[model samples]
Target: MLTVMRHELNMQDRSFSTYLFGFFLLETIGIAAMIYNINNKMANFEYCLSTITLVFVLIIPLITMKSIAEERKLRTDQLLYSLPLSMWDIVLGKFFATLVNFMFPMVFIAVYPLLFKRYGNVYLLTSYGSIIAFIFLGAALIAIGMFVSSLTENQGIAAGISAVIIALNYYSLDLANITSSTKQGSLLVILFFILIIGFIVRSLTKSTLAGVILAALLAAITGIVYLIKSDLFEGLVPSVMSKISFFQRFYAFVNGNFDVTAIVYYVSMTAFFLFLCVQSLEKRRYN
Candidate 1:
């Protein structure tokens, strides 16, 4: 794992991706700082972090697009499968390596609170708290991006899909507000989600029967529950969407709440996607 990590880091150093990521982070922070300076009424660093959060939809894909996709593209994944290291080791090594690369600029970001303090009254607790949340959010998104990369050998496709996924998550709160909250509406939306999940399962397992069976079972169960107790699903879609939203959870921290639940949610999300990445690689070995 360490060897893989070192190799990835060395590769990143030789490539432009790391530099591009750094430049984006620096530019985002600069813009945030400038905005804050112009509007002295907005003194919180969380505001700056919030302003830059959407940029992750673009920047994270740049770093993670090649993590596993490039390996597959070059047919080196077969060599990895032959190695004694488990899939977990490879996935984690790459994840941590990309995380380290992402963290390079974050070191500079961590100092922003002190700089704000030097200039005027700053809420250190909330500022640092938001920063912590921001890091975890980025880490979780990176994990998601890596999982997306594992799905495709083409880095461009991986990046595009990752960007779309992140963009959807970023705007999920607004989406939920606009979406129907009625029981029938929620049921239909959930059924649609189940179909999408089935497609993903079919793609990953390459088993139409497995995907059909899983989707049918889930859809049947959901249908039965909806028929039996329609009220149970009232406003369910929006509520669930808001709860699972990554940005919505982070806003708690930005609002000065050191929410333990949000931290756990981010950690859980990271672990879940990393596990999926491992499974995706393992599937390749079987194929």
Candidate 2:
């Protein structure tokens, strides 16, 4: 695992892609912070952080697009598959490598609160909490991005999918508002989601029957439950969609509440997606 991490870190140093991503990421965040904190005289660094978080939609793909896609493109993944390491080791090494690279700029950003404290009163607790949440959120997004990268050999395709997924997650709360609230509507939406999941499964496994069976079983269970109790699905689609909104959870810290639940949610998201990445990579061995 450490070997993979070192290799990835070394790869970043060897190529211009990693530095390009880091440059853009830091520049955007720095400009935002400068405009808000210095020019605008805003005391709340968290707001500046919030404004800059949107840049992740652009930068995260850069960080993760080449993690696995390049490995596959270079045919290095074959070497990884034949190595003695377990899937978990490889996945975690790659994830943490990306994570460490991601954390580099954040280290400088962390000093913003102290800088603000020098000028005037800064809400240290809330500011630092939001910063922590922001890091976790970025880590989780990187995990998701890595998994998206693992799905394809084309960096552009991985970047596009990562952008779409991250953007949707960022705006999921707003999107949920447009969804139907009725039980049958929720059921149908869930069925559609299952179909999408089936598509992903089929793409990954190349097993149409397995994907169909899994989707059908899940749809049948959801349909039966909706039929048995129509009331249970009231606004369920919106509610579930809301849960997927990454920025929504971070808002708690921005609002001066150190939300433990939100922190847990981010951690869970990171772990879940990391697991998916491991599975995706592991499947290559069998495929």
Which candidate ranks first by lDDT, i.e. highest?
A: 1
Candidate 1 residues 1-287, lDDT tens each?
Answer: 99889988998877798799889987998788778844665668888888888999999999999999999999998888888988888999999999899889989988877877887888999998998898899999999999999999999999999999999998888888999999889999999999999998898789999999999999999999988999999999888877878998888888999999999999999999999999888887677
**Model 2 error, position 266 (Å):** 1.3
RMSD per model, one decimal:
1.7, 1.8
After the best TM-score superposition of candidate 1, give how far the Cα of residue 29 lies from its true spot, in angstroms.
1.3
Model 1: ten consecutive residues of lowest lDDT:
34-43
| Pairs of residues clashing in candidate 1 | none
Please, what is the whole-model Cα lDDT of each candidate in the order they appear? 0.90, 0.88
TM-score attained by model 1? 0.94
Prediction 2 TM-score vs. true: 0.93
1-287 per-residue lDDT for model 2 (tens digits)? 99989888888767676777789877987888799889999889888778877888988998899989999999999898888988888888888888888888878888889988999889999899998999999999999999999989999999999999999998889899998988878878888999999998888779999899999999889888888988989999999999888998888899999899888988999999989888888787777
lDDT of 2: 0.88
Worst 10 residues of 2 by lDDT: 12-21
